[model samples]
Structure formats: structure tokens, C-alpha cells
Target: MRRYLPSLSALHAFEAAARYMNFTRAADDLGLTQSGISRQIRNLEEFLGATLFHRSGPRLVLTETGANYYRNLALTLDRLEEISIDAVRGRSVDSSLMIGTHPTLASRWLPERLGAFIGSYPDIPLEVMPAMPSTDFETTQLDVAILRGVGTWLHARSIELFPEVLAVVASPALIPPGSKLDPLQFAEFPLLQNAGRPSLWLNWLRLAKLSYSGRIQGTRFAHHEMIINAAIHGLGLAVVPTFYIRQEVANGQLHMPFGEPVQSDDSYYLVYPERKFHNPNVIVFRDWLLRSLRKA
Candidate 1:
């Protein structure tokens, strides 16, 4: 580490501020006062010798330099978090939870809401990894997993956080308002694909009574957020879990083409090995997760 490298505290404040574009919200997320958040960002700007934000009458907008810096810094922070967790273990006995989850929940859902959970349990840092549909108790030393499935996993205890709801969403440019679209009408736009569930489109089409004359062709992405971003960019239509796209849909960046919500046979679940079911950390997280979900 060099003395010239920006401090992690200042960088973290800027990253949260950049992501939300609001100092007050960022301050709340970081558990700092509004003035404290502004001070930290100002310190970072001075250290970098470039203006990161244009503070315009109560609105904090990122400058071109800040926008570019934020983008790379965000990725850097994610990798740093992963590396930090991997290189270290619990600071003391029962002080952390080794978590496993899919990218969509981790990226779109957890990071934003994690501040509250951390604020409550500051001692138990989370060491998170990408998890499979079924937790690998034999191969991995994970304490818990957030998986998307029906309310069952062999040899594991589980609970459903919420039922998975899906919607056929795409960029509004692809499907304008008041368009009377038959099920097959959607085929006119290319279908984006999720590698985890290759048959998602087929099943949804079957339920919706849609038939396509042409082949469904589009890019395949491993993460749900990737497809959703592509859909927002007008690349193709995507059948995605509703929870993941609420913000985008609400912001009018994405539109529902079919105007009907699809209920999936599965849902998001928190699972852990039955043998370690009584672990205090796991139990606390499970309770907090369910309570938080209810509150949300």
C-alpha cells in the first residue's frame, strides 16, 4: 500500500454517493451524517486533484472524471471485498457468516440493503460466494446459502423468503405503449437468454400460449442482471424475476411487454446444512432475512 493511494473510507463514501447520486441517501446507507458524507467526498476530490462532483444547489451530480472513476472503482471494490473475505476468516469464533448466493440477488438486492443488516450486526462480516441451486455441504464450508428454488433442498433445512414473480420486460423502444401484442408478437424482438434456466422462455411461452415461427436467438448471460441490463438497452426482451427489475421498471427505463406477471414454480430461499442448523450466526441471519423481507 502506498501513501498516495486514496483512503478506503473516502473511496467507499464516494462509491455509495456515486451509485445513488444523492448524498443524504448515501449517508443513510453508510450510517453517517449528511455533512460527514460530504466531507469525505470532498477529501477524496482534493486528494485526486480533480473535481469528482458538481454540487449544484442541493443536487450532487458526478463529473465526467467522477463518472469514469466511479465505474472502475465500483468493480475494484467488489473484487477487493471478495479477496478480503477469501484471504481472511472470522476475526474470532462465530464472528462471521460464510454466505453463498446467485449474482442477481447479491448485486441487485443485497448490496443496497446490506447496510441495515451490517448496522445491526457489525461483528458478523459476510463472506459471500456464488452458490449452486443446492448447497454443497460435502465440498464447501459454507454456513448458509441464498438459493432460488422450490421450498426444498435435499439434506438441507430451508425457508422461502418470497414467491418468485416474473415479467416479460424490455426497453420501451422495443415495445411502445398501447401496443396490442399477441404472445407470438414478442418473437419479433430477439429473446435474451439466461444460462442458468435455458428453458425459461419456453415454459413462459407455453403458459402464455405463445408460439414462435422463428428460432429464439440472442446472447446468453450467466447473471440475471446482465440480461436485464441488455433488455434495458433494447438488445432483446427478457423474462426476469420481478423483484430484480422493480427499480428499473419504476424508473420507466424498462417496460412490460405482455402486461401480465408470471408466477414461477420456485422462489428465493435461505438454506443451510441440516447438521449445522443450530449455529447461532445462521439462525440470526435467517430470522433477520425473513423479518427484513416482510418489512420490505
Candidate 2:
């Protein structure tokens, strides 16, 4: 039985042409003449019985059908290329583990502990990518991810790592060394804010039982690391996760006047696609991560 599929050469030609929207550039990319790319795309369109491009325009444009086709086709081509490369290298289908995590955790917390994982499993290759906001396994090639939330992601199995512990810290110059902070005094100084987590200060205020009514005029930072750096420079008071600021506190760069750390409802979780529950690499990594963090 013949499969109803277009030729690989024609598909490649159309994909490249659609990506650059210029036959000359696509031909240059594939080391072929402009006519060759155009002919291949024409053949592909004829085979599929659909108009893939608008030739009447000043610049080449993909039709609605062509755009939809390209989106799915691109992902398929990428997966095919990955499998082909792995086959050429004589490795198993799932030979490597790609982990995605937030930039904050990757830069501050993970590096020191990664060495132990490498030393233990020298045979397993690893790649770390910065996954912002959230992880979508269907759209990404990551085998596992570390996320901060309540372990409620759809279609993913989440393993709780640790609950978030926050501490109110500021430069010693701003609050003075060895001075205790009163709950109401929180509104006295400028409050630095995390743009990503706007409710952090409000939540902390509620937990501390302080009803702040004074106006807060402070700079809002996009990243948590920036907020920590700003607090270190005596710009304002910042509430940061204790884990990320342990070194700063130990070195007296930041003073924690608020005595007790505040607990957050969210926890850090190691998550993977529910379908990957039986995958050997995912299992190995999950075990290693849980064990490593447990001892920390």
C-alpha cells in the first residue's frame, strides 16, 4: 500500500520557502537554484491539491492553509531530525535528559548541586534550558521541569520538592544592625517590589498582621535577583526566598530584621509529562533529584 505523503524533498523545499518567504533565500539555504525550490514547492502544492502561497502579492505570502500546515510540519520535521541523529549516533530513543527550570533557580540554586549529579551519572548527558512562566511539554522537548506552584499542572505528574520560605531582608544601613522590626513599621520604609509577583508584599503584610495604609513609592523590578540586588544596595526593603539569600545573610550583606521567616503556600515541584511515567531516563532523574534535594 502506498502512503499518502508528499516527497521529502518537496516538503523540505516548501518548509524553507515558507520560513524565509523568498525563493532566492530558500534556494541559497538549501544550496539549490531558485527555480529548483519553486518547482519543488509547486509539485508539493499540486500533490496536496491546495494553494500554498499567494503569487499575486509584491512579497510571497503563505495562505491560511499553508500557515497551519507549516506549524505542525515544522514540529514533525524537528522530531524526525532528532530521531535520525540519535539513530546515527547508535543511542537509544530516549538517551538524554533535558531539564527546564526558571532562571532564578538555575542561576542561584542548581549549579552547585549539578556537579554531584554529573559525577554520579557521567554516562547520562544533560541539558538545562530556561523555561519561563510555565512549562508546556506538548510544545517543548524538555523531559522534565522544575516549577514553583501548587503542583496542579495539567497532564503532568508533579513531585513536591520543598515549600517556599520567605524572609524580609534589607541592607544594614537602611535598618541598622541588630535592630528588631515591628510589624507596623513595614510601611515606614520604601518597599521594593517583584513585578512578576505583585502580591508578595500584600501577602506578607497580611501574614504579619500589619494593615499598611501609607503610600509605598518604590521601584518595581522584573526579576527576583534584581530585587535582591536592589535591597543589598540599601535602596529598600525586599522579601526574598531564604534559600536564594542564605549567602548574602551569612556574609552580613543583608540584615533580616523580621526575625521569623514567612511560609508561602506554593512549593517547588519536579514535574514531567504524565505519559512519561514509565520512561527510564525520567525515572532515573526523578529519583536523583528527590534524593539530592531531600539531603539538602
TM-score to true structure, per model: 0.67, 0.72
Candidate 1: lDDT over CA atoms? Answer: 0.82
**lDDT for residue 19 in candidate 1, whole number 0-100:** 78
All candidates: CA RMSD (Å)? 15.4, 7.1
lDDT of each residue in 1-296, candidate 1, tens digit only: 65778889899899889878998899999999989989999999899999999978878789999989987787678657756765686344246788888988888888887788889999887877788895545334578888888877776888888888878887888887567777677777788999888988887877666666567767898879889989988888999988898899889888786778878788888889786689999998889988998897
| Number of the top TM-score candidate | 2
Model 1 Cα shift for residue 164 (angstroms): 1.1
lDDT of each: 0.82, 0.84
Once superposed on the true structure, which residue ranges of model 1 sit more than 4 Å away at CA?
Answer: 1-90, 211-214
What CA RMSD would candidate 2 show? 7.1
- Writing each residue's lDDT as its tens digit, candidate 2 over 79-176 gives 89879978898875477888888877888898888899889998888889887546655445678888889988876888899988887898988999
